[model samples]
Target: MIELNQVSAIQQQTQVFNQVSLKIGYNERVAILGPNGAGKSTLLKLINREIYPVERAGSYLKLFGNETVNLWALRSKIGFVSQDMQEDYTPYTSALDVVTSGFFGSMGTHAHLQPSDDQVALARTLMKQLCMDIDEQRMFQRLSTGQKRRLLLARARVHHPQALILDEPTSGLDMGASLGLLSLMRNFCGEGRAMIITTHHIDEIIPEIDRVILINQGQLIDDGPKNEILTSEKLSDLYQTSLQVSQNDGWYRCWHG
Candidate 1:
């Protein structure tokens, strides 16, 4: 469903992505594991066309086989969810209102934006599926971080996007809230939509995300089955730490002695 060949991202005359190549097939779930400054967020933006890739010979990005296409249409096909999406929302917007706005491709509900009864029903159904019980009247700014995240997921999936791209999904979430978010995503994985997740924490990765790609210093280090790519030495090197990684029943964790 996605392909990037010899892609590089340049910002302020500095390269944040260096000849990176990766492919994600339709309905394939994958996780991108990287440390700080590894350009994970940049990679997501590149896929969504939020930032243009460096235009050069032999470097190209193809979405559904076209190097050039309408970004607005591409956006509807892919649900790009991220921490940055939180900033676009108006502080006083209700959670339901926030979700309904996704249908119109707006950050939040607006004065002229009107949601149909069917769309409102769909949004509420998605909210319940994500186990979000926040009052429809509750201001978005008042909801907890996890609640906001769940509501956003509802917004993204309201249209059954072909793929979901999540960047640092659990960054500021506490243990309980993180688990809740993961659980929601875990269930969504089996519904046949693809997911590309970028995270520093290993445990946030769901087992259904059977493919793992590690990027460091803005380059693709490795890509393969999750079990093969995510290991003690690889992770330790990626993070530049003396760390030990452990896994149980396909769940991974990191520690240091």
Candidate 2:
């Protein structure tokens, strides 16, 4: 679903990601895990075309099949969500309006933008599929974090994307909210779309993700099956600290000694 060939990205005179050669197929579920400053977010931006890679001979970034896909077209195929996206939302925007904005890939529905009957129907259907139970007219800021997250997911998938990319899907949530988010993520996964989530918590790499990619200091460090890449020593090295990895019911998490 994604191909990066010797890709390097620099922003504001600082190199955030470099030489990240990787290929992910259309159906494989994957996670990109690294500590803060590991260039995980930069990589996602590159894939999502929110940022550009450094120009160099033989450097390329392609989604699905072609490098020429328009950003709008690219977005329709891949749904992206992140903490910053949540913060960018208009506090007074209603849940339905938020989802409606997804039709145009805008931050939130604005006065200039109007939703058609079909668009409203699809948005409501998506909200239902994601199990969003909030009153459609409730303002985004008034909703709980978990509810907001679900609304964002509904917004992201309003166009029915072929893949989903999440950055820190469970950040700023308690155990209950985190699990609730996970359950929604699993439902999204059940729709048979490719999923790539970048996270600091091992438990966020839900069972649906079969592959894991490790990044650090703006470089792609490791790429392989989740089980092989998520070992105690590897987790320790990835975080730059000594740690022990634990697993229960196919979920993984780590703790420092």
Find the candidate with the highest lDDT and give its number. 1
**Off by more than 4 A, model 2:** none
lDDT of 1 by residue, 57-161 (tens): 999999988899786678678887898888667888988998998888888777799999999999999988888866888999999888888888888887788
Per-residue lDDT of 48-121 in model 2, one digit per residue for the tens? 88888888999898887787778788879888889989988889999999899988888877778999999999
Clash number for candidate 1: 0
Question: Which regions in candidate 1 have their CA more than 4 angstroms from the true location?
Answer: none
* Residue-pair clashes per candidate: 0, 2
Per-prediction TM-score to the true structure, in the order listed: 0.95, 0.96
Error of 2 at 28 (Å): 1.2
